[model samples]
Target: MPRFTAQELDAHRAKVTQLLDKPSIKVGMSTCGVAAGAVLAFDTLVEEAKSKSANILISRTGCAGMCSMEPLVEVCIPGQPAAMYGNVDAELARRIINEHVLSSQPIVERLVPSIEALAVAYDKSDTPTPPGASGPRQYRIVLRNCGVIDPESIDEYIAREGYQALQKALSGMTSEQIIEELKVSGLRGRGGAGFPTWHKWQLTRDAQGDEHYIICNGDEGDPGAYMDRSVLEGDPHSIIEGMIIGGYVIGARQGVFYIRAEYPLAVQRIEKAIRQARAAGLLGKNILGTEFSFDLEIRLGAGAFVCGEETALIASVEGKRGTPRPRPPFPSVKGLWNMPTMINNVETLANIAPILVRGGKWFGSIGIGKSTGTKVFAVTGKIKNSGLVEIPMGTTLREVVNGICGGIASGRRVKAVQTGGPSGGLIPEQHLDTPVSYEHLQALGSIMGSGGMIVMDDTDSVVELSRFYLGFCVDESCGKCAPCRIGGTQILRTLNRIADLKGTERDIATVRRIAHAMQKASLCGLGQTAPNPILSALRYFEPEFMERIAAAKTARKEPGIARK
Candidate 1:
């Protein structure tokens, strides 16, 4: 209820830090955690603590990049590192409270290791890489506060140095200085395009427009990707801080959050954070008693994957059908009702505050080449440790699959990993060790996508996977352009025919031709990249297609009574 001032931030942070030193139990209560009975766990902990008269603070926070471990329960005692337990239920929560919170002993058998604790073999190498981004306690950088702090608690977020970047930017730095910091940080857009963030801000700032707009694209409809949703649910304050900084840098009075309607919890948490921010003197007119004034609103997407594209997203935000328009006058030049607009991905915006807080050079030094800063991945499908994994940009696919995800869950030989989403290509097993970057993944016929890595094993068929991804794209196609609309359908048809065991080499050529046409002539990114999955399949597993065609040929040979 009390408004915050820049002068009072440090003293409040120190007080909160002291409060965290007491005994506490924190539950991972994001959507994944909730589905896995996190609410039951939290309830059990509260009931037990009350029954036992235990002096421990029971709270709920966001996923710690470990969705598989939910409902995760963490117990912290003064001067001791928090111990995390996974797959918790009412019984487990009670046990955690009794053994860990009341007494000092952890339930050793029920404990789950941090992401940094695993070092599974990658590509049969003696030395396997770790998803190294943080210290012994938790994941660092963009996801720094994610499993550690309660999303709805503004004080906890501030205690963890949230919004410090905005205060720093507002008090000390100019718009050009902030852009220069981004340039030094080498931060590129993480919305799958790899465009430089600083350049986008610069262009939007320089564009001649009476009004400038900022947008966060949270419409991550990728099948296995939930990076944006998690951040919005877990650490909404950080993003609010990031957006305010972005608005200040680009001289925008307003910002928009275009999130998918499927993410109810994310929507709830972000809305709460926006209100908290406004009440805390961070939003609306004259924030921090400075000239900068910015406010935000939420726009729900109808689960359309194509809206992830900038122009299509703009159209959707304007209450029209979600579709892409031509790109001659890019969004930076003219967008959102012909005003200069800067749309940043959720993950991209999450990085802004961190880059400003910890010097830009420090962030740029972490990842390799132009791919600076860490990326958050929604690791899923056929993997032992399926969850969220945030690692440096240059980390190998093999490392992500084996080292972080603990490789194939079925004990089958690791076959391939699908990066990007429905619009990304597949990386065959042979190239697993290749570094994961925009350029490196592209070289291996895959892409970094929005950071959805689906690990596939030997039992998984490339034809089937390709069919699945292409089918998703086809279903979600805006149908605005003939090439994407027709070509995607034709390619899906051929893949279906092949799966039905009634196709030949000629059919494969037809598929290739159609996919190429879709790529070259599709209206937006959805159409342009719809062929990625099939094209990558053909590039890596054409022999599988041949095998299927050979089976059809054999079936027709002398065994059949009639040939067609």
Candidate 2:
């Protein structure tokens, strides 16, 4: 591997910038896109381009966050703007090559209407009427390069000022300076807990150990969340760059990416990024002609939801069962291999490079209050424009649900907005104006979990939602402790009884009782937070549970069923 000076990196970035200048066909090949048959669309584009002898570049990019409109294809014609089309199949891919690629006509039916204004300058044939000409503008810090550049291309990443942060950190800034920058940024963990990132780094830096390590927690198992996966797939180099900066800041020479095996594309891209970084001398010994050296390795999790917790993640990386232990000696104090460690989630790490590139104060000034910076949400379920949308922290639920996501689908009235996945709680529609800060959501009985915001309309049942989420938690419990394992199952059983027309007030009481025990006595976060959905549902929709109980009483008095 050749060691690169800053000048050489700049020279390389200059060369990579020209790749996007030519007419190119960039396909979104993230997991969502792949699931929607993007592989076929990509292949058809390549074959058709070759057959037509077209002077166009065929490449793959990551998800544009619009999972609902998968198999997304973006066309960049020479001397024109780049237009994105959705729901692209192989046949549509052929049309994209023949009609849009060879000719100037864009297939209006497949075009994602909201972004047309940003990409419609090239089509001088006719003024095409956009479906919905406007939408809430998204602030893209973590997701700036997503769906724009090829994830597997290191040069493309460098072209976008990617490794410029690493060069700055390694060549000029001291470790303490970097930590102070993060402190100034006011960045909190996006992995539900909302812990201050800089404080964690400072603790690990101050902690004495024989050797230090850093871990990137990519085991994002939140049901509706794919923010980390998309970032890893869309902009792998950003995460790599962030990890490298973190390693340097904490004085750790080695880092580990604890990603789930289910995310094959993310794992593949991260591995490729690591290999490329190592080869380019951005990783390994004495990075960027400095004495500081850091390396990264990938560790796959077996799809355990609990492993998203730091202690459980550390345990999983150490070849042990993915269950957490007590945490007085936190991971920062004693982590993997019994050394001081620093762990950051994928989104938190993604923010690192940007914060360094454009000073921390600039990042801090974006969002309101203590929650500074934008949050990348995997907006899914019942929303008209469901995809990945990154908004500033102080943004309200009304802005996200109504203004940005284009309101509820089918004109149905929204019942509640579920954030934080199973670990988090529900926000009733009445509180739509609540700003999406960590403190606000926590006050509403939900945590700002790893960016999974599942919207629910009137058709969704509160009891049913609780049951489904509880069932998931019960199934994913590591079973190392009794509170989570036994309490989770018992709560599920009680919820089932309520759903089955056989519940009583006593059953609901039992749920609260057991939930209290789990919350207070659970070993890990899984146990501690597993009852969140159940408790929050009980808190917000108690009438629904009571209605079931009242109906059951009425039925018992009328039928052959005996009253106990």
Whose TM-score is greatest here? 1
The residue ranges of model 2 lying beyond 4 angstroms of the native Cα positions read 114-136, 561-564
lDDT of each: 0.84, 0.87
Off by over 4 Å in 1: 115-139, 558-564
The clash count for each model shown is: 1, 1
Clash list (residue pairs), candidate 2: 65-388
Candidate 1 lDDT for residue 516: 83
TM-score of each: 0.95, 0.94
Q: Whole-model lDDT for model 1 versus the true structure?
A: 0.84
